[model samples]
Target: MKWMEKVEHMYDQFTVREQKILVTMVLVVVGFVFFMFAFFISDAFDERRERIRVLRETVTLLQKNRNLVQESRQAQASLELKAVQKPPMLQGHLDQIAKQYELSLNFTPQKPKDLGENQEYQVESVELKLHDAPIKNLMQFLDQIERGNYIMMITDIKLTTRRGQPDRMDPVLIVSSYYKRSAEELKALHDKAAEADKGKDKADMKESTKTTKDDL
Candidate 1:
């Protein structure tokens, strides 16, 4: 009680100017505390808002990627369906290629042996015994083999001078070129080829059917 009374007496003894100064100081301190709290809350909200913004952006990007993936899958499915409808025509195409390349196939075509469930063609050497030919023909033959559809490999080569030809040191080249199918590689190549041909045939059949139906 005595302390309270002394405090009241001291407050009463202060001049009006001192009293105004004391009130102002208390108000300023209270205002400072309020400002500090407001600043702290504002900073916290700002951080949370920034984090939300980043998460939203990440989600949007992921959604875009998902859409792109779906589109790619759809495109691939359509292409596969088309391929499945066509028929295989690689042999005819190979013949046409041979004609276009002007390559004369000296070897007889043989039925490729089925190496059991392996549909991939295997290349076996076709040996040839030839007298030497001119350098130009030899090079052309090699070039044709390189550019041909079937893999042609030269297994053996012998160079000899032409009989009755003088200065025969630059002898004519006799090459044994072997033509064979590609090595048996299980890469679904045969399946894909078959599917592509099937797709082409289906597409043609559908067109023909459409034409007949229209005529009717």
Candidate 2:
């Protein structure tokens, strides 16, 4: 207490400019120390918060992907159990389709030329030499083609009546269509599927044999 009182007395006796300089120096040093401590603590907290936020976001993304992965696995399991037969006998299917429509027409399937990657190619075109028939038949034929199993589209059309000969009016319809590797690819995929089926069959046989031996 006595030392503090003597220091206060000495501080009061100093000149105004000296007191101001001493006060300013002490304030500057204190402000610098506070600024450094605040900056360090703030940076550390911000870094920890950022790490927590990133971890939370990562967990959310993983959970979302987990559902997708589960769905894909289920789909794979179903596909492995049951699969469709492919390269569906085009000629027979086409004949059946034509018969179903009762359309007197010719189907000229061309040899499929390989189109380069991601390029489109024309598949088959049905040239209909229409007889003197009602427009209803034509509409039905077009509708059947449009709604058929394979992808088919109507492209080029030409309608012409005879110049001189009456009672013989026929329209020439040349329709272009596009085909993809969906069916052929499906067929090729079956090669691998066949191997998988054989493996499954063996596994099933082994299980059945083991069950029979246990029963015995």
Candidate 3:
């Protein structure tokens, strides 16, 4: 209270113009302080908003990664379920299906090939030629093969119409079956091949040594 009364007493001593100038300066300083405070508050809010936006983006990315992982796991599970532990006898299976449809099939077994970069699976395929087969029977045969217990697919099919019999078709089919080999099985195969190679090398060395003894 005493300071306020003293500031009033000092203000009363100044001329009217000076008093007006002093009041204007005080108002400007107050306005500048308020503007600086408001600017800092606005900047703080903007920074917080930016942080929240970044956090939301991160959360969305994590959710997408989780979904991808789940999808991959599901696909792997489906593959494991469908893949057979042992290769199915593709020729016998095809013959069985053809019998069910009452269609005669000429079977030609294809060379089996290892699948995947790691050779963890093998594909066994068979080529079949059906002569003078009815279209309905052919369709049924194909359906049966596709719906069989083993993981089999009709990789290729070629149908040619008979010259005189419009209802009969000559169909050539290539069926492939997939089977998974366990790590132990693959290791055993590799070991067996290595042993064979070693045996061959030893035989060759002995033959060379015998020739050298004869020359001496």
Candidate 4:
């Protein structure tokens, strides 16, 4: 109270214009302090919003990765179920099915192929030629092969009707069966292939050297 009385006595000593100028200067300083407080509060709110946005994005990314992992696991499980421990004799299997359907067929066995980056599986395929076979019997033979206990699928089929007999067809079928391979088996196959490639490369080099010597 004593300080306020002294400030009033001092303000009464100044001219009206000076008093007005001092009051305006005080108001301006107060306004500047208020503006700075509001600016700091607004800046804090902006930082909080940015953090929330980043957290939401991280959660979304994690969920997507989880879904991808789940899908990969399911696909691997399905592949395991379908794959057999040993390769099936594709020609013999086809012959048995053809005999069951009372259809005569010729089989051409193809070379077995290793599949996948790790050589975890191998595929054995066979090509079958059926001449003048009844369509019904052929269909039954194909269905039996597809629905068999093994993982066999028809990769290709070409059917042509006999000149006059629409019910009889000459069909060529390509069937493939998948089987899993052990680590040792994969390594052996890899080594064999590598050796074969080395041999071929050596033969090619020898031939090239011979040709060059002959030219000289």
Top TM-score model: 3
Give lDDT tens digits, candidate 4, residues 1-216.
999999999999999999999999999999999999999999999999999999999999989799888999997887687675454577877787789989998888889887898877788888899999999998889988977445789999999999999999999989999988777888898899899999999999999999999999
Instruction: List candidate 4 segments past 4 Å from native.
Output: 1-76, 194-216
lDDT-based ranking = 3, 4, 2, 1
TM-score of 2: 0.34
> Arrange candidates by TM-score, highest first: which order?
3, 4, 2, 1
Local accuracy of candidate 3 as per-residue lDDT tens digits, 1-216: 999999999999999999999999999999999999999999999999999999999999989799888999997887687885454588877888789888998989899898887777888888999999999988888988877445788999899999989999999989999988788878987798899999999999999999999999
> Model 2, range 61-98, lDDT digits (tens) per residue?
98989989899999776543332212244445444655
Model 2 C-alpha RMSD to native: 15.9
Provide the RMSD of all predictions against the true structure, rounded to 1 decimal.
19.5, 15.9, 7.4, 6.7
Which has the better TM-score: candidate 1, or candidate 4? 4
Give the winner by lDDT: 2 or 3.
Answer: 3
lDDT of 4: 0.88
lDDT of each: 0.56, 0.64, 0.88, 0.88
TM-score of each: 0.33, 0.34, 0.62, 0.56
Note the clash tally of each candidate: 12, 0, 0, 0
